[model samples]
Target: MSPNLAWRPIRFTPQLERTYVQCMTPRIILLQRLACIIGIASFVGYQFWDLLLDPEALPRTAPIRLAIIAMFAVVLVITFVPSLRTPRYLMIQYIVVYTLLGIGWSLILAKLPNGFLAGVSGFLLGMIFIPVLVNGAMQAAVILTPLVLGPLLVMTLAGATRLEIVNAFSWIVGGAGFAVGFAYLLDVINRHAFQLEQLLEAEKTRSEKLLLNVLPAEIAERLKAGEEPLADHCGSVTVLFADLVGFTELSRKLRANDLVNLLNDLFSRFDNLVEQHRAEKIKTIGDAYMAAAGLSGNKRDHVAAIADLALDMRMAFVEFCQDHHLELKLRIGVHSGEVVAGVIGRQKFAYDLWGDTVNVASRMESGGLPDEIQISAETKELLPARYRVVPRGEIEIKGHLQRMTYFLQGGV
Candidate 1:
């Protein structure tokens, strides 16, 4: 059977995994300490009663007291020792040392004249609480098995009364069954909660990714922060607009899917070039692609970056048409000036530029020839010294007056 087709494994993310190890584990160690303290306190209080009534039993009680103390000291070290506090060590300590301690105490109690109560209580205490300290159901069961059975066997062999034997056996079986069942229930709940947390976290990440793809990172953050009327004045920026020439004619001839595929293929390449030059792709409207530079706050190189982007996009458009056996052309126009750029409208957020600069950039594209980079004079001045541009004497733009334009010839 293939791995993908096999049962899916439960995987916890780093945060959920850490919650179990770093956060939950320490608290469990504290629970173990509490359990030990309560057992010791109860036993000591009972023994004190005996001490006040009859001081003669101290000789036999001394060894049992010392054994309890020794067991506690060992557990204390395992609980707090930096190296031994790990889940694995805690489980091992419970299974091996704790079980031995239980057996040793039971042996001492059975040897005593009247010690059946103490021995049975100790066995039940360890069986019931060991599961609360360790994490897994299996580990809890492993620890409870020896801790419960070892003491009962010792009491039976040490000449415990028949009534005492029956009582010890009942407590052992009942406590073991309860501990195992309760631990498994808690384990199931923990796993279910971990899985739920992972799913919610994964969905949050996927939503954030989709938001970033739609808006610029900064804008997306602002929106998430509950900022409204998002707007910014980009003091000086460069905008490039490219319209696919012959798209109208090709749309009439090509099938619907074929036309969409062609457009998607060409625009995908253009998008890469825009990203390569650190430009913000404003939006793609129909067959027109708009992008800007300097909006990222570092305005010093926007002009040169947009120029490079326009050139690369021109080459990409040509190569895409050739690869797919189609005749297509890109008319790109670039302009540099101040403009207001921001996410506009609440229903559907669209990051766009406004002002004469945007309009002039659009005009440059409309007036541009096929397979040419038409640039306004503002952008032409900012071109690097190595770039070659040919001036196109003043042209009459629709709404704007006469403007000096140039064709951005190939660069060095």
Candidate 2:
């Protein structure tokens, strides 16, 4: 099987793109520093070797020494100067000055006795390992040209024998081939590493966004940090359930896509209201939307917050129905009590609430009339004096005994 066939490509989001760009500058700078150190140190080492080998040759090679110093100055500017530190700028400096330095070294060798034994081929091989400095194939080829041919050109001009010239030419060809091949391999490896980093970042961002959608921010973070079997007891939390009236019959009249779109539009409006009131939306089942306040912390004003959310939802539905020329009504029910909330299931897990509080809240919505907000007696007690709630008398609820319910009228 093809490797690409099994690999699922991740989409690089805008945030990940910015992260990649931010990462690139520092990585390039690090490689440039490494290259500068290696290049400079090698030149110094070669100069010392030449001195130890042929001390008399130094006076004759004064021009060559000056050329090496000039190359050193160029490298310093490319390394320490901020403007000339980029790959493009450094590439230009290396191509021009380093090439000339290679020619000067060749001239120095041609002037000395037993010049071939100094091993100038080793210098040509060092050109392959400059990391980020030699970024492209063309740049590598340019740097190799002088280092490869300069020796033979100088030997020819200095009247070397045919056998000596032929032997040096063979060494030059071998060194140049190895340098070019190594440069290409390094280029491939560096590019592959960069791409792998980008893909990993993209995957991380996608996972975080998916987790946040399923759980609250605080809970998602805890789960990411390896918290398991997540569960919590929330006391004095308010649970609100809002269901769309007449949606079942409406669905029968419209196509599947149209019905889905309508539900998405209505639920999306309710979602905005939940956000505005700082209430966490639990999940939507069919046409019903569930939310809770104080379950995810911030319990001081949970009752008032849920109350505000219900009112906003009522207004949003009114406006939405008016704009769409539809006659949809919203029935919202709220109750305040103790409940156990937690994340469950190892695969496709969901954050959900349990206990009598959740059960009674659902009953309040199912038992209530259309176009109104209903509240259990427990929720009514939590409201402030400024808000108005009228008793609906004792109403028998399914799966439970008779309990007092109230209608939540408009607040002052």
Candidate 3:
């Protein structure tokens, strides 16, 4: 069977227009429609009343009052068209169109000797304000004032059976006065809207950066999209466990605030070392600090990176204690193997590591003595020429068999 020619295409009708309008932001759509309707209604009412009541007595001298009516109808139709929806682009169209509307209506009033029917005058003077409110008084004036003035001057030359040479000029001056007043209000609204949009964009960017700092970049993206992916990514990471050996004595000697400040200062130095080696800071629980390279994020040569960080932390603490006339000892243990690390809690989030490697590394720290840097035999083989190490006889690591460990001094 052939396709039915009667159903070739359904054109966009009033029903389709209404459906589209409903889908747009209702408030802005309603206000723009209402403003346009009010202008058109007032213009029609005056045109009808003047032409019907007494065409001869009516003060208009325009040979083409029908043309002015058509202009206003076109303006109202343009306001609701979907093409004028781009905020930036539509704003330009709005400014140009309303500017012309303001000038054109002012000219129609100018052709009348008395310059506006009392009720229509109020609306014409009042409704001609959207442009001024949206752009600026000066801008609306510069764009529109001339379009109205020249047209009005020509319309004023029309005669009510030869009344125009003297009477219509007075109406032109009065119409110009109303345009100036309405244009000022338009400028205020324009400036205010622009400022608000700029501020909103700045706040959005600042919030994005703050989120990246709080959560890793990948986690932040998942949060924005409302997905809670597995936070842990398992891998063979190098874990480092460090603690102050004399934490008890250090806390006892200093005031509570001073102890906290000292810990903060010591940890701050350690944080720099960790970053320098591109490691993830696992958490500082009390005087104990834990870090790992290559978990929750990627790394190259994870074991060597962590060993360098551990050595730097040890030296930094020694220098800190010596400079302050306080004795500080650091026991750091590093192990390279498979482990799981992730943020574990909802509130007061903590990044923690799990698995046998984390346990063995912690045991190496607990088994270590004052001022010593210890590591698993697995970790020792990755060391470069910068660190010194000596084999420590097999030490029993909790939950595991006795494993040979090493003490890190300077370089091996």
Candidate 4:
């Protein structure tokens, strides 16, 4: 039998709506500016019409034409004012500009000889062009209503014939229908583009997170910045290596999934400790976990940070064992010295550390007893006086000279 699934309804939440608006604000501002420029040009250019079509009426119409031009100018100035450029203010400015223009043009056309025909032509032009400025069909309807009806009313009052008024009305309605449809189509296209941009942003964030998980944040940024064969040499660094005791034998007795689950639970706790101490987890090899401090160039107290991380890992492992009802122990070893760190590999690349420090740290873990935090003399000398340590004498390290080491017990 199939299990029942709960599904969330798909809709644009308020947050998404606000985001869409914000994304489209620049485009809206540009359109508003374009509209203003066109309005200004049309008014200025029609001065020739005033001279040609009806020179006698220019004296009376000039003030109305200048007034409409001044209104468009005011709105255009508002668009450049950062404080005044909000969605609400832009909407108000849009309505005011177009409404005043519609009214102003209607008055001017009414004074002409062929007033009815002139008004109808003006109405048709407004219906075809004005809707592109606003976003939705409803807003287009609101702005177009005044533009369409004001001229018709003026023409009717001016004694236009019934046939002339009817013909103009049909043309006005058809133009409005076309304007509303165009606005709706633009609205749909803008929304789809907004959603696509949002998806791309989300994917970019996810990819960055995954990259950070594999590499240190600084190294990841350098890689992203196109730094090829990235590497850095540090004079001082503290490295830690930890291995789970008895994990090999325990894995043989448990199922693969169970074994992995148990390892993951313990390592997750260690990861938290690493973060708390501000140390970087280098990588894990089988049951072993490696970490480092001072890779970010903090050479002063990296040893103490790694020491605190090792101590905390032991305590966390104890709690983990008790909860899982398993017999397990953590063996941690630390060493402080210079090393080379960088990203390596063409495919499946990783950030790693190399040199004597990392190897000595690994040997400290392998040579040390279970449930103990071991440190080389170099690391021990750097710890604060509050930490209590006991000498473990000297041990012969494979492929290296014998070195004095100590077991880090606790703070005094």
Q: Go through the candidates in order and give each one's C-alpha lDDT.
A: 0.79, 0.78, 0.64, 0.83
Angstrom error of the Cα, residue 375, model 2: value is: 3.1
Report the error of model 1 at residue 278, Å.
2.6
Worst 10 residues of 2 by lDDT: 3-12
lDDT of 2 by residue, 259-336 (tens): 889888988998888888988999999999999999866668899999989988999999989988898889999999
Stretches > 4 Å off in candidate 4: 1-11, 115-132
Q: For every model shown, what is its TM-score relative to the native structure?
A: 0.80, 0.76, 0.60, 0.92
> Which pairs in model 3 have colliding backbones?
132-186, 132-187, 133-186, 136-187, 387-410, 387-411, 387-412, 388-410, 388-411, 388-412
Count of steric clashes across candidates, in order:
0, 0, 10, 0
lDDT of 1 by residue, 76-182 (tens): 66677888887777777777766776777676665555677644655666666766776657777888878777877788778788888788778777878888888
> Runs in model 1 with CA error above 4 Å?
1-90, 104-114, 122-136
Ranking by TM-score: 4, 1, 2, 3
* Candidate 2 residue pairs in clash (backbone atoms < 3 Å): none
Which regions of candidate 2 are displaced past 4 Å? Answer: 1-25, 55-84, 100-104, 107-111, 130-132, 142-178, 188-200, 252-257, 298-300, 323-325, 377-406, 410-412
Ranking according to lDDT, highest score first: 4, 1, 2, 3
Give the better candidate number (1 or 4) by TM-score: 4
Model 4, 1-412: lDDT tens per residue? 1222112112368999877777778888887788788878988887767666687978878899899889888888888898888778777766666677667886777677665565456556556555557667878888777767776776677677887788778877788888988887777666666767889999999999999889989999999999998999988999999998899999999999998998898889988998899889999999999999999995478988888888888888889999999988889889999999999997899999999888999999999999999999999888999899999999989998999999999777
lDDT of 2 at 145: 82
Best by lDDT: 4
